[model samples]
Target: MAAAGWAPPRLPGFILTERLGTGTYATVYKAYRKTDTREVVAIKCVSKRSLNRASVENLLTEIEILKTIRHPHIVELKDFQWDSDHIYLIMEFCAGGDLSRFIRMRRILPEKVARIFLQQLACALKFLHDHNISHLDLKPQNILLSTPENPQLKLADFGFAQYMSPWDEKHVLRGSPLYMAPEMVCCQQYDARVDLWSVGVILYEALFGRPPFASRSFAELEEKIRSDRAIETDLVVEAVKKDQEGDASAALSLYCKALEYFVPALYYESDARRKEAIRAKVGQYISRAEELKALVTSSSKSLLQQGNPARELLREMAKDKPRLCAALDVASAAIAKEEEGKDDNDTLKLYQHSLGELLLLLAAEPAGRRRELLHAEIQALMARAEYLKDQMKMREAQSMGKEALAEPVRSTCTLQ
Candidate 1:
């Protein structure tokens, strides 16, 4: 049931300022910590009455996952408390809203922008898979944008994320129908690859403005998914093929490559081999890029369309002005040289160079002026740097996919 028009119950030491959003099991609110200089956070309140046995089990599982995992792209859980009637979770506030709303508003994001978001998603998923955790619900709705200015993306909503042992089998069929993987639709014992499939669907949606597979009803959606149809790849191919034209095109191409790398192999008989290849490629890319990818896509009509004044201002600040121009030159050279080879050591060196320059830029300003101007500038630069890093990673991932295609086929058939 909805909580009295989306208003969260007030709690001690935390003031509920505004309702953030609501879901089936909980109502999220924007709250300020009174004891910590009014630091803002997102609070999710799940009523005991709203959670069934399975939901409670899920909540516990989420707690376990959150407690054990830590990463820049993952949402941070700060604290949790339970009253007689409900459970409360305090989390970092993502000012930019969820990816679903962003997509609906933007219609579709540029392929380059979408790829940046996907790379981050993949890195986060890779971490989760490595730990044997499957985020059963892997849709745009659960991906939150960290800030409009910085465009950082983070995954949220662990209600359907489950811990899977290496030897265990997954049989539960849950998640939005349009995004469900083939194995999940068939109710077969699946694995972490199912999440990869979901990532493919979401990535497709990010570029095309619609889900890869869609039907009017649940049955039809399931039927479509099981049919193993490959959506038209033309848009992505076109975006990538035009890379020679400019920065935007090159960015788009990298994103297309990342999408191609993670696409589910269900439609292709060579899926298992391809997945292995992708895994190896992802590792190589991660090593080369020296940073995880994170992409944020907002509705085209939102701030993206409004024109980024902060970004524009920074660009102007760096223009032909010799001194500022030199810094840009140094930063660009370091990034370019760092990505010159696929060697892991070279990649780390490049990451360090870029990171140092970034930190230096942040430190250049005096403390008094730092908070208002320098902080925003540094965030923008970091976000842009992150985008470039992801593009390189995308290329590496595609290279791996190509290598997989060259490998001998291996049977992935298994009994549940």
Candidate 2:
């Protein structure tokens, strides 16, 4: 009986064929023009009664964004109309449905396929980035596929999007909790970087068939993103085992990762005794990590000097470009200094200097083999610099924490 009574909304100049989809406040239907061309389009009919003040503003913003932009990967809004009871938006009819259905059909995507999809998504994001627009709600359900054959991703749902500069920060909640950044969930100010974090989660889900947290509760996801205590514990245990086994290089990397998580743990600790205990552990980690930095430096230098075909080839490729050649040489010197077991401060400076030069080079580098090599080198240097930076912070925190622990622990009991 329910199926027998279904009827599409009445609209002029178009013949409604079937119901395509539905949401909380709107229903979409496949329709065709009544003219000779019979142009097909998807009409999103939003009930006027369902929209409040905020939703009306969001709807206007979405229309303005879609009207002004013309990217291949972003959904298009051709026109809009309003009657007594409802508002209608005429959108491009995508034959292949949204990305959520695509992923559900495949269970998991191959790495190559996933990478291609990610590249397309990045192109769309870069366009938005150039315009200073943040699609605060980026999820699989909001990404549509343009066609059934050779389907291309079209980022949709700008209901929560906003024009935000990189340095502009806000604390208002704007996204699904499952894909939101820790800073957003914790009521802390967050900027455009939240989009990058969502992209990472989407990529992970594409490759693995589910998110990293799977079916975990929001609290568990929050802990994983914020404190990361369990992850830190696992990493440090492995780091210690590696250190005992004399693998200084691997241990150093693991220790740095563990130290990054300890920052939050220290910030949230309330008990005096527990804070002291955590600080003692951190101090021990700082000592070993510092020693390993020197050992790893010399070990890496020798090994790198023995064989670094990639670096040598890159240097050779840049022989014609003097500025690029200079940047490559600076990178080489950074490696050499690390290999020579030089001071960590000096080595870190060299790495950062090279990175600044190389990043500039990369932005102007054309699409080709050399450009690909340059990008890879930049990524490697960025990772190294981040690790070194984390270690440096750990050392500073150890000093401050030790000083704080100098005083005797105060009991919670109040004196009468």
Candidate 3:
């Protein structure tokens, strides 16, 4: 939420509860969907007059890009409306406020906290960049948190966003000067890599409470930005090296950085062999990170569950049935290990939802080894679910038994 101290505006279908903030061209409000009270959303209201040609084009681009994307770290655009006077964009509400406000309130986040947000941001950026979308304005203010304590950050405010291919050249200069990449300031043609530079700046600021470059004047800022060799990943590189020297925690910490760097490298690399080499490195790092995290956290169960990279690769390859089976195998193992004995309602509900998802995927998969695997996995999950239900019922009966036994003694005590 950017600082908008304006009066709350009204929309027909939404009940605006609080004014979130205002941007240059729009005001945002926390609103409830009238038809579905449980649905909370942020409605960005912009007057038609506020949009010039460029602004209108930007709005369209944002809508186009957002409509196609579905990632946890990216803010979901639920719906939009164009009225006679204004356009309203309904988005998922971030209860924790924007990253800028969070930083100002807390000064600086701890390393682990910063890493979680940064990792998620990197993932969001990877997804966007993969789809040829560039979120040019990558700053704390444009990043929103799902909650203050939980802190699931969502990328927001895509007004300066652009869709550029590897060969395309972008001459326009936009975004906050403080966080702008050197290439952006130099008027050089840039691609998704510029977003990566902004990620570095944000990460630095999160750790140190200030951006990498601080200048008194715009001219000085531009000079500093252009002169800086590259966004410093020295800290990350050092962490990785330390991890190789046998630091489990450091290894866990550097996992996302490895992933972050790997994404852009893999996406930009034209040579197939080189890309595969990078993929192997990323896979090894991630697998090691999971192992190290498990070692660091001494729990009965593994702290980090394994995700099937093979399945993900297959999905990317569009090998549908094989991907489905891979997904089912992963989920089945996790469920069997984690929820076999748990009878809690919430846990059961979650397992049921997961099984339902697998069922849907299974339906789409063609008949073969993949379909057979899905069927077997689904049956196993169903059996586990029933066993859990039986456990719950037994507990309930035991509780009732105790209550019944106590009733006779209570009556005798009252008579006495």
Cα lDDT over the full model 1? 0.69
By lDDT, who's the top model here?
Answer: 2
Using all chains and alpha carbons, the TM-scores for the candidates as numbered come to 0.58, 0.55, 0.54
Candidates by lDDT, descending order: 2, 3, 1
Give the clashing residue pairs of candidate 3, or none. none
Model 1: per-residue Cα lDDT over 1-416, one tens digit each: 23566656867888887788878989898888988478989989998998889988989998888878887788989989888888999898999999988989988888788989999999998888888888889999999999976588899988889887556777887787788888888778887778888998898788778897767997887776655334444444554454334435344445445545344342244555445545554344333222223222222114323433564455565564455445545545544553463554454455456557656666665565323554664554455455456555566655555555555555545312
Against the true structure, candidate 2 reaches a TM-score of 0.55
Which scores higher on lDDT, 1 or 3? 3
For 196-263, candidate 2 gives per-residue lDDT tens digits of: 87897788688656765543687777766665232235567889899999998788877766665464
Give the residue spans of candidate 1 off by over 4 A.
1-4, 228-416
lDDT for predicted candidate 2 compared with the true structure: 0.78
Instruction: Estimate every model's Cα lDDT from 0 to 1.
Output: 0.69, 0.78, 0.72
